[model samples]
Target chain A: MKVILVGFGVIGKGVVKVIDKKKNHLKSKYGLDLKIVAICDRSGAAIDENGLDLKTALKVKEETGKISNYPEKGKNMSIVDVIKTVDADAIVEATPTNIETGEPAKTHMIEAFKNGKHVITANKGPLALYFNELTSYAEKYNKIFRYEASVGGAMPIINLAKETLAGNEITEIKGILNGTTNYILTKMEKEKLDFDTVLKEAQELGIAETNPHQDISGLDTAAKIVILANSIMNKNVSIKDVKLEGITRITPEALTMANKSGYTIKLIGEVSENKLEVGPKLIPIDDPMNVKGSLNVAMLNTDLAKEVVVVGRGAGDIETSSAILSDIISVYLRTKNE
Target chain B: MKNNKKQKYNNFNKTLYYYGENMITLDLELKDIPGELIRALTPISNMGVNIFSVIHLREKKTDGRVPVRVVISDAGNRLNEVINKLEEMDIIITKVNETTRKTDIDIVVVGHVVDTDVRDTIDRLNKYGLVVDLDLSMPDPFKESSARMKVIIETDKLDDLCKELDKISEEKNLLFIKSF
Candidate 1:
């Protein structure tokens, strides 16, 4: 399979590293030989019709901070240009998310489909804002679109519901979708620290971003839930449809009070038949939903299966790349016979 | 005639009502004094009802009252009599079987809990549910204070109570973190 990586940030670099690491395994286990035809970043794109060397790609990206600096295969070409002209079977759209507009990534995906290429993206922006539009394009061009990494990174949720638990009628989906907020809340409850104190400590420890508005303000979780609502639950919803509440107001005293009643506070994002909301909810201390630390957990309420809970690391370079790689292989297996 | 009546009562006691019989679960709030639990259970015992399991929620005690779940065999169609007897003894029956007569909800309010007319806040919430337990923590008067309250309300009125909390939140600039 020939693939084009659309972004060269942490996740993009991680994808290159993973594909290199699993080259032999992918070939031996599934008889699948994967190749990266191009890697795009803000600096430009590096193209190789005969498959770019994975090691040199990572080295150039690390040393020069750009894939366009690759020895002779690199060029100053836009992402759209690469999508339109590159001879590749699929495009792995791992661009940075723009929740407000879903731009750039949105354009990249639409162009990928229009140019007769399949898309396997981990971008949440376009999915949250333009799911129907983007999906319509994919169907119009008859390309397979897979995005298991968008929701719970490395935690099989979208595919788990749509594939493994396909026959069950899923009634509700709820869990802690964001890891940064979970870390802050878990630390606060454990040490009885205020939100500001704990958040600063998390930022220093790199668990939280310097500007942690989206994760802390529930926007990130809202975006992910919107994707699940649209794709898994078959609900036509967007980011604005979520009734959001952040954890800024939570105090140590509040956690103590909740503990008094055998409960703990978590920023739970819940989507059901009559509800779509994200806020601080009281989870029973011993419940499965009460996973500590930066781990993410989700519970799917289905008619036949009753209830299914999934827990995993919601973020990381290689962790997220693991999910992206699965999608790549899935696209391969499904289209291999064709 | 008195001997016959005594013999019938004795027979009712001897008949063991085990599984598959009509079982009634009573959710009661009892005073934390000695023999309070027995005082709440003695009425049904005298009515010839077989007792099953008593789950005492000791950790959920608030305001000197412990919540206990008492399951008993409702033999002889005496559910109403058991309820009346317990109520007559001043035992607060919060729920019976699957029907919730009343339920306890906890809310942690953050803000100037005392300055923003906390009395009116509680009074407004009291319209939908009774504020049974309140624990206030005021780190500094100039800063925001936190208050934890336990409200016992009818299950049907939970939505109304939440709406009222939202209204109070908007009106007084307070954040009500509720346990749903």
Candidate 2:
């Protein structure tokens, strides 16, 4: 499987590492010889018609923090150029998310589809912003558009909904879709500390991002819920439609009060056909959704399967990349079946 | 509600097996010896038969021997080997019952379907067999409402499923009426 990997960020590097580590295993187990044909980053592009040396490319990126220093590095070649010109089976889009515009990643996805290439994106921006349009484009071209890593990292929730739970109608989706806030909440509950103290600790521990507005304000969860609503629930909803509420108002006193009532405050994203919302709701402490640390849990309410709860690590380079790799394998299997 | 730490089902039940191999219950008589029960189970486990329940009917024993009932599920034909091994150990092989009987039944559950946790109700029904379809009517859920559910289950355990539904209905103070 020849792949055009766009973005040499943490997730991109993680995919390269996985492909390299699982080279023989993928071939022996699944009969898939995944190779990186083109690697494009913000700095420059690395192109090899046959297959680029992934190990050296990764080492170069690590040392120089650039893909342009890689062997046979191509200049003046845009991400769109690689998607259009590179001879590959799929495009792995692992760019940082820009929920506002869905940006260059969205444009790259459109171009990949236009060029008759399959797409596997970890960027939630494009999907959360224009899921219908992009999915239609992929379907129009009869190509696969997989983004399992978009919502729940390595949890494989999207595939679970689309495949495993296919026999049943998913009535609603509720989950903890952000890790930073969850860490804060867990800390607040455990130590009985205020939100600001927990937030500072999380920042120090590198759990929360430096600019934590997206996470603390619940916008990140809103984007994820929008994606789930659009993709799984088949709802034409956007972030604008979701009633967003952050954990900023949750105080130690309130958390303790809720705790006394056998409940814990968790930032939850819920999606139904007609409704989409992300807010700090008081869930029973015994509920599986009330997990500790940065663990993410998603519960899908279905008619047949009942309430199928999926818990997973929602972030990390390797974890998120695992989801992307699974998507790649899914595309490969689909193409093989076709 | 969304807080993100992600994990998935490590031991996912393979629903595909339900179609090929049927669930079964085994009844055997074994001597009241330390290794006798263990010896009888070696063959069953080796054959990859999933044991559902193992009931040692000690009170119903006769002449230093006890009747043991084992409920297993598998698609493979390995019961002969199991019986042969039990016979070698001087254990009696009483019966081997397969749960392949199929039955389709429709049920109407009344009163506050959503407020009473309809998802839990559907999930409970699905544990028996396949919940074929469901039609819910809740014009106003705050008031009384109902759901018409269709289920295709193994005929042998139809009564068990009904009893479970009855318990749920009684506990929730709802009406569970099975329609022919």
Q: Kindly list the interface RMSD, in angstroms, of each predicted candidate in the order they appear.
A: 1.9, 19.1
State, as a TM-score between 0 and 1, how close model 1 is to the true structure. 0.90
Candidate 2: give the TM-score of chain A. Answer: 0.98
lDDT of 1 by residue, A1-338 (tens): 99999999989998999999999999999999999999999999999988899999999999999899999999999999999999999999999999999989999999999999999989999999999999999999999898889998998899999999999999999999999999999999999999999999999999999999999999999999999999999999999999888999999988887888678999999999988999888788888999999999999999999999999999999999999999999999999999
Number of colliding residue pairs in model 2: 19
lDDT of each: 0.91, 0.81
The 10-residue segment with the lowest total lDDT in model 2 chain B: B1-10
CA displacement after TM-score superposition, residue A271 of candidate 1 (Å): 1.5
Positional deviation of residue A128's Cα in model 1 after best superposition, in angstroms: 1.3
DockQ for every model comes to 0.42, 0.01
Model 2 residue B135 CA deviation (Å) reads 42
lDDT (tens digit, per residue) of candidate 2 on A158-249: 99999989988999999999999999989988897878888998899899989999999999999999998888888887888987768776
